[model samples]
Target: MIGLCLGLAGVVWAQLPVSSFTLAWDHTVEKIRWEEDYRLTETGLVLEEARVRGNGAGMEIPEDARLEKGSWHYRRPIPPLQPLSLGRTPQAGDYQLCVEGDCHALSHWVGAPDINEPAIQLWTCTRGGDAQ
Candidate 1:
């Protein structure tokens, strides 16, 4: 039926666009709690810059970008790209937070663990239009 066809078209339209992914740190090893914010790029419509707040230190993502401090609170202006990543080694304590966006299907790891080692959660993604 036309109704089914139209519904499918709208679903495709709302899907995420092409995106870039990168990782950054606070120049520290252990992160107490980290929040990384991503925003839209001007032309590329891709994920360009990411801001990470961890261990009292903050940084703009891409590792080679820049360092800034104070506040990991979520704000407007979704980062460019479809996905981005922030890096940190979790402390021995417990912390809870969100990684922004619809990135849930993405995986997490620390230092790219060996196949045999237990996977450490260091990265994540919001649902990619299919989390449900």
Candidate 2:
């Protein structure tokens, strides 16, 4: 029994430098979609450059950042989740980890449609920049 206990202890001690949920995220949503409710589970976010995805659109955005989707123009805020350990499994709510602040869309082309509606899209660090 003692030997088994020591083995377990050794295993735990072997895995060092493990961090807890240190990263959290936040977001503000301004969209017109029906699923007003969403979760944060996909972290690799980017700003401006957005492409169409399955059910809805997906963008690489930062933590606590806001983005617009669909056409309803519904507005809401998205909160970040706790940081998942290196070996831990992440859930749906664990994906919203990114930098904070506004992520604006690219400037319109010359003589383009004038929506006048500014939508802050989601984004993440592309070059491992600051996370504040």
Q: Cα lDDT of all candidates, in order?
A: 0.30, 0.22
- Please give, for residues 6-118, the per-residue lDDT of candidate 1 as tens digits: 00212321233323332333244445434443333332223334455543334333434445565344333553322222222233222222234333322221123234422
lDDT against true structure, model 2: 0.22
Question: What's the C-alpha lDDT at position 86 in model 2?
Answer: 19
After superposition, the stretches of candidate 2 with alpha carbons farther than 4 Å from their true spots are 1-70, 80-128
What are the candidates' C-alpha RMSDs?
11.5, 18.8
Worst 10 residues of 1 by lDDT: 1-10
Q: lDDT tens string, model 2, 62-92?
A: 3443345532222333343222121111221
What is the overall TM-score of model 1 with all chains considered together? 0.24
Candidate 2 TM-score to native: 0.15
